[model samples]
Target: MRDYPLENRGAFPPHVAAGAGASISLAPVKGGFVIHLLGDAKSDEAALKKALAKIAPELGADVRKSAPNQWFWVGDADVSSDRLTEIQAGLPSQFALADQTHGRVRMRLSGPSSRTVLAKGTMVDLSADLFAIGQSAMTQIGHIGAMITRIEDDSFELIVLRSFAGSLWDELNHMAAEFR
Candidate 1:
């Protein structure tokens, strides 16, 4: 993997994933962190709620549903790093941690053109009112695990696994090329 430091002054690396599909790298958002977790029918929602409620005051946790069985808790500026131990302590054993280093891929797309290109294949209504800033949802773009978020008025970010990264990138690039 090519290293692009946060301080680097250039466009992000074109293809960020090592596996088969197209991928782009999204710069880490300034203060927040994305913690991926998995829960089953047997999983404890009460514990999950208790954990989040405990940390909410400090981190400002917001739960965003990505898929039927997956979810992400976004912690705010003061809340993320400060309470890692407490957060982990609160989580059940089944929850898997997916942050930058361990995840298959992390890519961000934000621009006026983001939505236009995305609309070509995505069925989800990405209108501003429905998917406001910081709101995240997990749905399929074709067959991939497309976790899309409206980062700004015109920009959106999609995160998929490394194996499918290339295909996703190619799909978006092909769709966006016409716009250019």
Candidate 2:
């Protein structure tokens, strides 16, 4: 398996990395950065709560459960400035990111056709009744490791592991192109 190093285009559009089995686009969203909290037995909820409280006043963020098991304390992009430091300081343990070697990939999919495109590969009923705006989930359509999140009424973002990014993108692009 060949490896393609990620492009370092700080604060711009994501760098696209493509290889034999997968493709990834790491887009940087302004003002917000994802802090990967531990998901294993070592996860400390008390410390995470404390950290969230400390940053709440500074960033005015709203804490929401990301998936069935994951919690995310998100604020606007401005939260990146001071709130991140506050969260780090408040937590009893340091935040660690996911290992890149595991093929975890993220992308920002938005615009008018985002939802329509994702529907091609996803079976999880992307309709408004099931997956409404601001909702996120972890699931799989076929062999794809899907992290589907709704950005708006017409836009959605899909994150998958590097091994499946190309397949996911191709499916989405094919569906989305029809809308253009």
Candidate 3:
């Protein structure tokens, strides 16, 4: 597992912006906050959403609600740790949270054929009618557990475990090349 290092300086590289058809690249969200709600309070969606509303505008467009009890706050890596600390303070005692700053990596794919590229490895239907922009789901792409977010009309972001980033990227990049 001697893959290249994480881009500690910024969110990720923008090289893929130049690729043809569907471009594949690491999303520039170096680290983000992953909220893990626990206990009975976890089911209080309104309270949780309200609490996060304080910072929702700050996170801007990167805020992702991947699941019922899972919310990801995406922002600059340097500010994420402090931001998570502030957020946890507002959480109820029944809830738990952690900063998955180094455990995850986001892969971005965009263009007309982008969904088709990911469909080769993911069982989740990436059709726009079902998974529209601003929606996200926690699912598996091949053997990798990923949080897939449809960022735009033809753009999707795949958040995967860092341990499988290399292998997963290899698999996706291989399929995406055909669209080039």
TM-score of each: 0.60, 0.55, 0.75
In terms of TM-score, the best-performing candidate is 3
Find the candidate with the highest lDDT and give its number: 3
Q: What lDDT tens digits, residue by residue, belong to model 1 across residues 5-87?
A: 32322222354432223232233233345567677766664566566677455655455667655676655343333355566
TM-score of 2: 0.55
Which residue pairs of candidate 2 clash?
A: 31-77
- Lowest lDDT sum, 10 consecutive residues, model 1, at 1-10
Tens digits of per-residue lDDT, candidate 2, 53-161, equal: 6656655333334443355444444333243455555655544322232244455666555555566667778888888887777777556777677767765655565
Q: Give me the displacement of residue 100 in model 2, in angstroms.
A: 7.6
The local lDDT score (0 to 100) that residue 18 gets in candidate 1 is 28
Return whichever of 1 and 3 wins on TM-score: 3
Model 2, which residues run further than 4 Å from truth? Answer: 1-32, 39-53, 56-68, 72-86, 92-105, 111-113, 162-167
Error of 1 at 24 (Å): 13
Of 1 and 2, the candidate ranking higher by TM-score: 1
lDDT tens digits, residues 9-48, model 3?
Answer: 4333333544443344434454443443443534565666
Ranking by lDDT: 3, 1, 2
Model 3: weakest 10-residue lDDT segment is: 1-10
